[model samples]
Structures are given as C-alpha cells and as structure tokens.
Target: MNRIIAFLLLMTFCSCDFIEKKKVYSNDILDEELKTFNWNDVDEYPTFESCNSNLDNANKKKCFENTLRQILNDKLAKYEIIVSEEINDTVQLKITIDSQGTFVINNIVSNEVTQTEIPQLDSLLRKSLDSLPKIYPAIKRSQEVKTQFVFPVIIKIE
Candidate 1:
C-alpha cells in the first residue's frame, strides 16, 4: 500500500510539471486598446458653472462653447483697441485647460498685419481668460484630463 501511494504522488507531481503555463499577452492587449481608442475625443467636455451638467453631451458642449465665446466677447468689447490700419483677419487662440481646471493660453496665431496693428492683442487675449468663471476639467474614463481648443477670434476693425 505504501509503495502504491508513493507511486501515485510521484505521478501527480510529474503531471503537474507537464501542464502548460498560461501566458498573458498584456502588451498585445494594450496595443490593441490604444489603436481602438480615440485620441481626440473626450468622454466629457470641460464645463463652466453656468453650463447644465445634466444636459446631453452635444448640448453641454454647445453651452460651454457659447458661454465662453460670450464671455470673451463681452470682455474684449470693453477694450477700445485702436489699430492704425483697417484690419480684417481671424486670430486663432490656442487655449489649454489643464487637469487642475486652470486656463492658459498655449499660443496665439495672428496675422503679422494684425499683430503690428494691435500690438496689445496678445495681452488682451491673456487678460480675458483671467476673469473666467470656475471651470470643471474635462473627464475621460472617469479621470480628469487636459483639453485644448483652437478658438477663432474674428478681428474686424475699420
């Protein structure tokens, strides 16, 4: 009986060693996920306090954009920027909202004519963001994320 039990134990140990180890292809899975993920899209757009959070994604985005544009328009209107030459161009304002909900001007793209005519354009744009309302950072996969916007500001000065 002891000999039979010893033989069974040895067989069990040997058989266990022969079993294949399950390999985890985590890198491959990660690569596939990255390829399928949309890098430009966010789960939620950043919102201001006035924007209704319960609204649908499209409405929420529109509200946030309109609110921001309105605010910027109102602020810019206060400044009587005098340009030496009649200018009609658009300025592309690259604004970035960080994960901390802080607003910053990443870059200001303006025509040389516009820049020369209104040297204070950059400063004015920067100042407009200073009075922005409390913002909620964009959410992606339930995590706060930084977002960038290329806002076009039409400059029509006569």
Candidate 2:
C-alpha cells in the first residue's frame, strides 16, 4: 500500500512538470513575438499647409511651428483687451488633432491673474483656435494617429 501511494505521488508531480513546461514555452514565444512588434512612434509629424513645402522632417516641424505661431498671433490681435496694470502671464493651450484631422481643444491652463483679469480670455482663445485651418494628422507606421500639441502664449501688458 505504501508503494502504491508513492507511485501515485510521483505521477502527479510529473504531470505538473509537463504543464509548467508548456506555460514556459508559450511565454517565451510571446516574448519573442513582442520583441519583433513595432511600437507606436510617429513616422511623420502633423503638418500645416505652409509646412507642405518642406520635404525634410526637421524643416517641416520648424515650418509647422512657425506657421502655427503666426496664425495664433494674428488671430489674437483681433481681440481688444485692456489691462489696468502692466502684467505678464503665460497661457498654455493643449490642442489635439484627431485621425480625421479635426482640431479639439483639450485644456487651457493659466495663472489666477489671467483668469480673473482677462475674463473673456477663454472665449477669445477658443475663437482664435477655431479660426485655424485643418492640419494633417500624424502618421505612425503608415497609420494616421491622433496627436496632442502644447502651445504656450506669453501675454505682456505694457
């Protein structure tokens, strides 16, 4: 009876080893597959109409930034806001471009002074952003991906 019990225990242990081996092999295969996969990195950055002339990646990025800044500056100039005291503040705008090349305002961050002093600031900014032209969405491995961009506007009341 003792011999029978020992044989049964040995068989159970061997079956467990087989199950563990299968799991180990499957995990190894998955790891190897994961290493071969290409993760999401932008192959091409988002572009503006003015940036289309630049063929180089770095030049395209620079042109896009310059054009965007110019557009924002131009649009903001249309709004007339007066400050009683000379103040300096920075407004950070988080903008997102969807895969379909639609602009979406994610968030706007500013100091308390800007919020309180410039009551119409939010609406003005939104209007300025809404006036912008459509942008080309970023590409990741030939697939268009939604991208987020942060723009900081420095406001100085002289």
Candidate 3:
C-alpha cells in the first residue's frame, strides 16, 4: 500500500507538470505566429483622383500632397488678413479617409494667433477639404483600410 501511494503521488505531480508545459508551449506558439504576421506595411498608399496617374507609391504620395497643397493655397489666397506682428505659424490637420472613400477631418491644431485672428480658420479649412474630389482609400493586404494623414499648412503673415 505504501509503494502504491508513492507511485500515485509521483504520477499526479508529473501529470501536473505536463499540463502546465502544454499550456506554456501553446502560448509560445501563438506568440510566434503573431510575430510572423506583417503589421507595419500597407499594400498601397492612399490616392487622390489626380494622384491616380502614378502607379508608383512614392510618386503617388507626392502627387497627393501637391494636389492638396494647391487646392488649399487657392482657397487661402482668397483671405487677406494682416497680423499686428510678423508671424509664421503652422496649422496641423489630422485627416482620415474611410474605407468607403469618405474624408473626415479628425482635428485641426494651430497657434493662438491663428485661431484668434482668423476665427474662421476651421470653417475655411472644412470648405477647402470639402472641395476635394473623392479619394481612394489605402489598401492593406488587398483590403481597403481607413488611413489617417497629418498635414501641416504653413501660415506666414508679415
């Protein structure tokens, strides 16, 4: 009876270790699988109607920026506001394009002077953005995904 009890105790401890090791091994496998997945790269960058002319990623990005800049500059040129002091400021725009090719302005960040002097800055930006034609959303692994863009608009008042 004593020998049999000792044998049963040993089996219980060994079985517990085996079960623990199996759980640990399973978790390690999951971690390894996740590491192998590519999470950083998108198959295609976001594109504007005018940018679609270039199939190259770098060229597409440049075209998108230039097109957006031209449109915004044209709209901003309509406003003639003189600041008290010579000032150079940057307006940060956070824009998001949804998978359905809808543009959403996430946020606009600017200096106090820009906001105070140009109270209509936000609305003006919205209007400029609204004038943009439909955009093609970014693609990740053959699936269209919502992408966010942070663009800076430089404001110089002398």
Highest lDDT model number: 1
- Name the lDDT value of residue 119 in candidate 1: 90
Q: Residue 107 deviation, candidate 1, in Å?
A: 0.6
Better of 2 and 3 by lDDT: 3
Q: Ranking under TM-score, best-scoring first?
A: 1, 3, 2
With a 3 Å backbone cut-off (N, CA, C), the pairs that clash in candidate 1 are: none
Cα deviation of 70 in candidate 2 (Å)?
A: 0.9
TM-scores, all models, native as reference: 0.82, 0.73, 0.73
Q: What's the residue-level lDDT of 40 in candidate 1?
A: 96
Clash pairs detected, candidate 2: none
- Best-to-worst ranking by lDDT: 1, 3, 2
User: What clash count does candidate 2 reach?
Assistant: 0
Give the CA lDDT, 0 to 100, for residue 152 in model 1: 86
Q: How accurate locally, in lDDT, is each candidate?
A: 0.90, 0.81, 0.83
Could you tell me the lDDT of residue 56 within candidate 3?
Answer: 85
Top of the candidates by TM-score:
1
lDDT of 1 by residue, 79-119 (tens): 99887889999999898999999998899999999999999
**Per-model root-mean-square deviation over C-alphas:** 4.4, 6.7, 5.8
| Residue-by-residue lDDT tens digits, candidate 2, 49-136 | 7676547777877777788788878998987789876669988989888998888878889898888888888888888878677688
Model 3 alpha-carbon drift over 4 Å, by segment:
1-34, 37-40
